[model samples]
Target: MLIKSLPSTWDVEITQAVNGKEALDAYRAGKADVMFLDLTMPVMDGYEVLENIQKEGLNSFVIVVSADIQPLAQERVKKLGAMAFIKKPVNPDLIESALKQYGIAL
Candidate 1:
């Protein structure tokens, strides 16, 4: 869905992570500019990854895309440095809306 949502006018290189741990490692290596994260996963969860990123001062914008969509979860992720919180089963419209909300033109 994310791939299908990529703006035609924008060009970007994507890095895929299989799990939370790999995601963290990729960020540590400065491989990500924007991250679409899942709250639940093996090894490390999104919360822990976000915490680690904050502590390490990783310069990346995070848009959490998770199945957990409770208000508490949303608030928690926002406080933990997530720029946006989006629910799972995402679509092109949702992706575009999120980008626009964050003032991303492309």
Candidate 2:
């Protein structure tokens, strides 16, 4: 749903993973520039994925879009190295802003 919300003008490629482990695997295999992560997946979960990414020192920017809207959850992901935390039913404006911060022109 969030991916569909990206503007038609944004020429970005997107990949999807059903669980945290696959997300990590795809991140490594795809050379993804950005990731839209969910916190509550089976197998590894978003926190573990963030940890692994940090351990790998990967440059992919992460924008966590989860239903866990608590301030603590937001802070935790940020501390764990997510670039930004936006609530579920993600705002396209926020997504654009996050990308822009990473110097992604749109």
Candidate 3:
């Protein structure tokens, strides 16, 4: 739904993953420039994905978009190399801020 809400001019592409493994597969396949990850995904979690990405040296930027707002979780994701963390119920300002910080202007 948030993807659809983004402006068409942004020319953003999206890929769907039922779980973190698929997300990792897609990342390995060079399918994205930046990824928005949910920490509580099934099959594998975001932390696992982050670990795999770091291990494989994939060059995609990651932004965590999860309901898990715990300080430990945020710090862990940051340590794992996520570019930013955005909480759930994401607002436009936050989204824009993240994108702009990454140099992805809409």
Models, CA RMSD each:
1.6, 1.2, 1.4
lDDT against the true structure, per candidate, is 0.86, 0.88, 0.87
Off by over 4 Å in 3: 5-8
lDDT-superior candidate, 1 or 3: 3
**lDDT (Cα) of model 3:** 0.87
User: Which parts of model 2 have CA positions greater than 4 angstroms off?
Assistant: none
Candidate scoring better on lDDT of 2 and 3:
2
Least lDDT summed over 10 consecutive residues: which range in candidate 3?
1-10
Better model by lDDT: candidate 1 vs candidate 2: 2
Task: For candidate 2, give the lDDT.
Answer: 0.88
Model 1 over residues 1-106: C-alpha lDDT tens digits? Answer: 5666666765667888878999999999888878889999899999999999999888869999989978999999999999988787776677777777888767
* Best of the two (1, 2) by TM-score: 2
**Residue-level lDDT tens digits of model 3 in 1-106:** 5575454567777998989999999998989888889999889999999999999888969988889989999999999999998888877678778888878877
What is candidate 2's lDDT per residue for 1-106, written digit by digit as tens? 9887675678878888999999999998865888999999999899999999999988768989899988999999999999989888888888888778888866
Task: Look at candidate 3 and tell me the lDDT of residue 16.
Answer: 81
